[model samples]
Target: MSKVLTVDPSLCTGCHRCEMWCSLTKYGEINPSRSNIYVLRREPAVDVPVICVQCGLCINACPTGALKRDGATDAVVVDADVCSGCGTCVKICPYGVLRLDEDTGVAAKCDLCGGSPACASHCPQGAIKYEDINKAAARRRELWAMACAVRIRG
Candidate 1:
């Protein structure tokens, strides 16, 4: 699963449809408890949706060795049998989306929508886009180059 979900904080209206989509996929409910995407406020000014950093903080936080990589891909898998649901992984997640399911008491979050994120599909504002890290980086670089060229001409 690709980890990067590029977000435009400026365009975020904080409607939280992404969270709803995430929860529905994970828990079959509208509850944010199952969502792996976090919506943070930049105050009355903005709301930023934060998802997995893919930095491996939650992966590293797994003390029971429940969290493991797919080896064949970027997907992260959790072994519920080994998971004690101590909330360590949940607490360690910087995005705050990772949460201990109140019902199951197990940690859960966005698993990349099983590689086809509903958030990106359902985003009304076009604020979220799922793409490869390398391609996204290249796009950003191109934007920066455009900015530099415009500056020189102006």
Candidate 2:
């Protein structure tokens, strides 16, 4: 019953609060570059929050075997001691969530804040949520059904 981070792009306001909290909590600084969650902004006031889905792609991509899933949280854990600062994991991440922290000299991404995600907890706009995978999928399906109903009625 591991929970996963979910994002609602439509509700995001590009506030970057999630990034700030993440950076502060993990690195004790306000550097967004070190934050695992990134906000991708587009024209016309669109903001999309990108986060790690813990898909294990980075774990497989790591040549030094630095990345692995935490058995307790199911979040990607980066072993800095074992990591060689290679960018393979960064490049192979399908969501582009992984990045090499210049200060730490190791690949960094969301570790779910050791189970409770700060990004989801501190989001001002309710754009992010942490829930069980099954519940999240069911919610998405419900939203889709509501959208389709609206379209049909209109």
Candidate 3:
């Protein structure tokens, strides 16, 4: 069962705690730009946390075979040595989660912190969850079913 990071945008408070924790854990700093999990602020109070969902589109887009999935964590691992910093992976990423590190010139994305994601653990609003994709999909379907029932009754 592959687990993925899921975000509930409605519950996000835009505190950037996820970003801070991600940067601190990965880079030992508090730079949001370096954080793999980013907050997209569309309005003053509306924020969406953008993260890599392990969709594999970036892996296919990598021309140098630098991106591959880690079987243990199901997270995409970027091989800096093999990567040419071509930016194709970054450009093809649908969620814009991949970024080329300015200093390293290597593409960076969420690696799920080697299976225990810091962002999901530190999310203040319970907006982010790391769960099995099948279980998550089932829960989503249940929610939609309840919503439809309410609409029909009302």
Candidate 4:
């Protein structure tokens, strides 16, 4: 089964270890701006890790056909050679996870690190998990059901 990155905001502690590892693995540095996974912190002390869900929506939006899903990993990847850095993918992404690399002048986002994501593997809080897509969907449904039950009871 293909895998996906599942995020649990409740587990996140804003440690930024995911970002550090991601950038280090990808760029040989600890630059958060270059990391594909981003941690957004809310005013109420909430940290939400945002990343490419590999939904493939951006692939359809790429005019240059730079974005394509890797057959092995099901990861939406950017082909630097084909990418025009037009920023269309960035705008098309509903979650706003895509970006153009400042140095490369090319589109960049999570490629699941060739199927074993650095962000998910290094996340200290277990906020990000690399798991089967079906499992992730089932988990999401369970969470939704629990939330609905609480709402109905209250």
In model 1, where is the ten-residue run with the lowest total lDDT?
69-78
| Residues 1-154, model 4: lDDT tens digits | 8889998887999999999999999999999999999999997998999988888999989999999989999889899999999999999999999999999999999999998899999888788999988999997787688878989999
TM-score (C-alpha) between model 2 and the true structure:
0.90
Tell me the TM-score of each prediction against the true structure. 0.79, 0.90, 0.87, 0.92
Clash pairs of candidate 1? none
Scanning candidate 3 in windows of ten residues, the lowest lDDT window is 138-147
Tens-place lDDT digits, model 1, residues 21-127: 88887778887656778777876668988876556677887989887765543556667788899988878877676677778877776667666788877788977
Model 2 C-alpha lDDT per residue in residues 8-111, reported as the tens digit of each score: 88799999999999999999998888899999999998998988888998888799999988999999899999999989998898988888899989988899
Which regions of candidate 2 fall more than 4 Å away from where they truly are? 142-154
In candidate 4 the C-alpha lDDT for residue 114 amounts to 99
Candidate 3 TM-score versus the reference: 0.87
Model 1 quality (TM-score): 0.79
Scored against the true structure, residue 119 in model 3 reaches a CA lDDT of 97
Clashes of each: 0, 0, 0, 0
Residue 113, candidate 3: alpha-carbon lDDT: 95
lDDT of 3: 0.90
For all the candidates, what are their Cα RMSDs to the real structure?
Answer: 4.3, 2.5, 3.1, 1.7
